[model samples]
Target: MDVDARLRELGLELPEPMTPAGNYLPAKAAGDLLYLSGMGPIRPDGTLVAGKVGDGGLDLDTAREAARLTGLQMLAAMRAELGDLDRVRSVVKLFGMVNCRPGFTRTPAVIDGCSDLLVAVLGDRGRGARSAVGMAELPFDIAVEIEAVVQVAP
Candidate 1:
C-alpha cells in the first residue's frame, strides 16, 4: 500500500520525529528489523501530552488520544530512520505503557488507540503482537509511551 497516500486519506500528518533527550538513538536497525526507542505523545509543536490516566485524572478517551499521538511519534521516527514508510514490511511488536492511577486496569483498551490507528493506516501489516501495561510514572509524565519493532525491506 502507498503509506503516504493512506495518511493523506486519513487526514493524518506525522509530526517531526522527536530528538533523543539523552545518549540513546531514536531508532536502530539489526538485520531486517528496526527497533524504535520509546516514544511519547509529543505533538508537532514539541509539547507533550502529559498527565496520568484514570480516577481523578485524564479520562479514557483522552488517554486513548495520547496513545494515538504516541503512535504518530513512532511513525515519525521510523520514517526518519528508513527514509520512507513503505520500507516497513510489517509491524512486529509493540510494548505500550500507560501512566495511570493505581487500580486502573484498562491498559489494553487505552493502547488499542495506537493499534487501531496502525491497522487503519497499514492494513493487516500493521497488526502486531503487543503488550500493554500500566506504569505509575513515565518519562515526562506523559500519558502514554510506546516502543515498536518492525520488519523492514532492506
Candidate 2:
C-alpha cells in the first residue's frame, strides 16, 4: 500500500521528527529491523503532552490521545530514518509505558490509541506484539512513552 497516500487519506499530517534528547540515536537499523528509541507525545506544535494518567489524574481518553500522538511521533521518526513509510513491512513489537497513579490498571487500554492508529494506517502490517505497563514517572512527566521494533524492506 502507498503509506504516504494512506496518511493523506486519513487527514493526518506527520509532525517533524524529533531530535534526540540525549546521546542515543532516535532510531537505529540492525539489518532489516529498525529499533526506535523511546518516544513521547510531542504535538505538531512541538509541545509535549505531559501528565499523570488515571485515578484522579488525566482521564483515560486523554491518556489514549496522548498515546496516539506518541504514535505519530514514532511515524515521523520512521519516515525520517527510512525516507518513506512504504518501506515499513510490519510492526514487530511495541513497549508502551503510561505515567499514572499507583493503582492505575488501564494502561493497555490507553496504549490502544497508538495500536489502533497503526492498524488504521497500515492494515494488518500494523498488528504487533505489545506490552503496556504503568510507570510512576517518565521523562518530563509525559503522559505516555513508547518504543517500537519494525521490519523494513532493505
- Against the unseen true structure, what C-alpha lDDT does each candidate score? 0.93, 0.94
Ten consecutive residues with minimal summed lDDT in candidate 2? 42-51
Model 1, 52-121: lDDT tens digits are: 9999999999999999998898888999999999989999999999999999999999999999999998
RMSD of 1: 0.8
Task: Supply the global lDDT for candidate 1.
Answer: 0.93
TM-score of 2: 0.98
User: Model 2, stretches more than 4 Å misplaced?
Assistant: none
